[model samples]
Target: MSGLSVLSGGFIAGLFAAVTAAWVAVGRTVGRRPRPTTAAVFLMAILLTIAAAADVVNAYFSYLPRLGDVVGAATEGGSDPHLKTADLRLSTTSATLRAHPRGAVLALPVPDRGSGFGATTALVYLPPQYFDRPQWKFPVLYLIHGSPGIPADWLRGGQAADAGARVAATGHPVIIVMPRMSHGWLDDPECVDGVGERVETHLLRDVIPTAESTLRVDSGWTNRGIAGMSAGGYCALNLGLRNRSVFGSIIDMSGLTRPTHAGGLGPLFGAGPQAQAAMIANSPDLYIGGLGPGPRPRIWLDVGRHDRTVAVAIYHMRDFLDANGYPVQLHVRSGVHTFTVWRPALREALSWFADDVARVSAA
Candidate 1:
């Protein structure tokens, strides 16, 4: 289950979609042989049945209720001894930033240090084991959401909580932090150290420090991990690469190799040469080839076979990782760049990260 086969759900979903489309295509042929057509129909019928079963399994166990009773137990009314009181700087907000029970969802205040986009809120999930030992410092995973997305997207839109539940089942201690990555209502933070948003610095400067100070997160770089999808994925790569001293591993799903746009880039980054320069500097492709052995972190990159939009860039990233002698795990599942691909990717990453942390913590 920990192998590349972790992508079976995505592959099955893609196969289902393709078979459903093939069913339509075959039905549309006007003058086809009846025998061949019948065979095609029979094949599609069997495939569809199998696809339906997979979908049901994914929805109930993988998607809908990832945590089930475990999530409820964590969020319910109880005292978590390991919970660290958030150092709320703003007045009248400390009430909402109190100690949480194991598996509780907490809203933490992260001040915007660069983007000037008002006060930021990061949603964090405390695993069941977090409250079991009062003095234990849990490993942390920083999850990022894409543009046009909120912190809650990981909580609701994806199976992050379910993934956490799955991680907890391994009997490891971990913490999940979902920080607000968007700079504005219509902004793409680019997740780079740039002219406008500077979300990268925000993460290294504000987010990490805040989490370390407010939560019972282990500060060692080996105990920290980062991952994101789409734009957030790109950010994860950038931050994890440059801040290798902080993150021990990273998971990039459908991430862009470079910063580009179908439209003009003036709006997203800036309209000046400096912004263009920053974009080029932020391109992970530029740095991948030059990476040395000093600070190597476990890297995982995944994309869907049918995900035409980001597939090319993701492959480029995989190529760099392979060519540069960096030990990486790259997977191409049978899916598009949607939840079908991202959810499982996150789950596998979390599981692997937990195992990695356990091995390190044990040592």
Candidate 2:
């Protein structure tokens, strides 16, 4: 039952049936009992019913695939501190990946050198080609995970390692790095350099340099790409476009057009005229309109058909980029804002990026 998929319709139906039956049985058993006892039983049943309803919402969204994910999240303390790390020497390979033909994920402790934002451990997916072609320096793709998630969510939920391996099998492998966006699991900094967290500065000054220095990936601007889903998707577009000299490709999967927080922007941007200006500056769609003449990064926009507001934003961005003579690709699929759309989107975007990098390298 722990391994059962939460997204399965049959499973969801069965869950609802079981919960309803249990609630009904509890009510009947406690009927005509003492007032306090009956009331307690009713309260417990209501709480259980609410939990079942929450599970239905989770099933619809496919936040976590398996019931074990909840247990794992609790048991593992919401972090992968003990995940195996690859040898710093890029030429070597661990016995784990040596036996299998898959890429390996390494935990990297990126330091907060310049940006005051707290840094968490980053995950790097080294393709099979990295060990095979020891002399070759591969392009790097920075994958930003969604909020309410950790770096390991990219591996478990996004299936990023498998996606990177699939792209590697195509003979155009790239180094993929999934970095932590904030200090904790629920921190929603929006990947911006405002308030106490200088996330943008951290990515540019700390994460990028850390990867380049420690990994066997090319540090060239054209060889680097950034991608993310949900809020992280917005970060990829905003960060990649703003730092064209560092990143040459951008992929946004069901992302918003600007920085947002469920608790409002006051904590991150403050309350003043400067706050309004800061918010405007971070809005990708707003600033991209005034983009000056310079190196233009390839843009990939993908959103679900049922994503309504996000879909509209993505379509508008596609049209704007197309009309402005920028290289942009749009992919709209049938789904909502969930991993069902993002996993495939990441795979396709990475393939596209690999092809673009190959063409550039060949040229």
Candidate 3:
């Protein structure tokens, strides 16, 4: 849990305990022939009631809002909140285009760079201004999607196109590229050139080159920023850290810093200890830790407090970075592993990337 959430929980528990103690004390004083069993039952009932009340409050304020924010931020960030009526547009190919108040869509093709996965698809979001002013090419923010999923996950899960438009409206004017990785899981392919499958080669050589060529994008590494959720987050960190020549900044939203130690990774990569060693060597923490305090990308790591699954891993990453003297911005918020937490984290991450992008573009 975050410091605030932990404090809030402790405060509520203490308050309940104090009230219960007072009530028990009062009841004991008033009852001249109090039965021990009756007193015990009354105390238990009071405790249960207090616990239930705390749980309800926690769920409402913390959990519910987190979920709603994922949807609300994506839908509401770049639009007029006061407008109740808006037209929903439809795509030419019968894909439902949800209404957005501040952005336009661009479908870009991912080239076949000999990875055998031919011509992947990527969706780019251009701010509303791009339509009015055609000569401007914005710095690109390449967003990667998670595993057991495709590029569509960011659109469907985070509604990222709408979010990017909203963010772009605030003067960032970024082109958000959602690219599909060849491997279909949330773990990194180590970004190694020819290991199992050259996923990194496909990304850097094919996807990025195609994006830069087709889109009005800034070409230098300093103008590029990468971020992702879950598996996408893993890819972002892996690619950004190892290929520092390409990405200027990296953001990991609930991604694993180290490979899974539970033997799942070996089977996932279809290799044994040696392959796992290579993956670990390419991990962000190891590479970033070894850097000699020169020009490295800005790093942002965030996790939800109640996310029991990845919280520990995230904490280890944060600690490792700190101990290794790597510069990182860490945010631990109150929530679980759901999109509720990730969406807000993503918004904040984009804001950071936008700032970095602006600085680089202006230079």
CA RMSD of all predictions: 10.6, 6.3, 10.5
lDDT of 1 by residue, 1-363 (tens): 011111355656777676767666666774563477686776778776765665455443232222232244332111334333333345312234443443556667887655454568787777766655567788899998876455655765465766776788678757888887765423565676555555777787788788888777887878999999877788788888877778899889888877654355665567678767766667889877765776788899988899887888888887887787766888888887667788788888889889998898889
- Each candidate's lDDT (Cα)? 0.70, 0.77, 0.65
Q: Which pairs clash in model 2?
A: none
Query: Which lDDT tens digits does candidate 3 get at residues 34-79?
Result: 4778766776777666656654553432322222333444332223
Q: Considering TM-score, which of the candidate structures 2 and 3 is the better prediction for this target?
A: 2
Clashes per candidate (backbone, < 3 Å)? 1, 0, 1
As for model 2, its CA RMSD to the true structure in angstroms is 6.3
Please identify model 2 stretches exceeding 4 Å from their true place.
1-99
> What are the runs in model 3 whose C-alpha is more than 4 Å off?
1-101, 183-195, 260-263, 267-276, 291-294, 323-325
Q: Which runs of model 1 end up more than 4 angstroms from their true locations?
A: 1-102, 113-118, 261-263, 268-273
Among the numbered candidates, top lDDT falls to 2
Q: Rank the candidates by TM-score, best first.
A: 2, 1, 3
lDDT of 1 at 262: 38
Task: Report how far residue 121 has shifted in candidate 1, in Å.
Answer: 0.5
Residue-by-residue lDDT tens digits, candidate 2, 249-311: 999999988887878999889989999989988897888778878888999999999989999
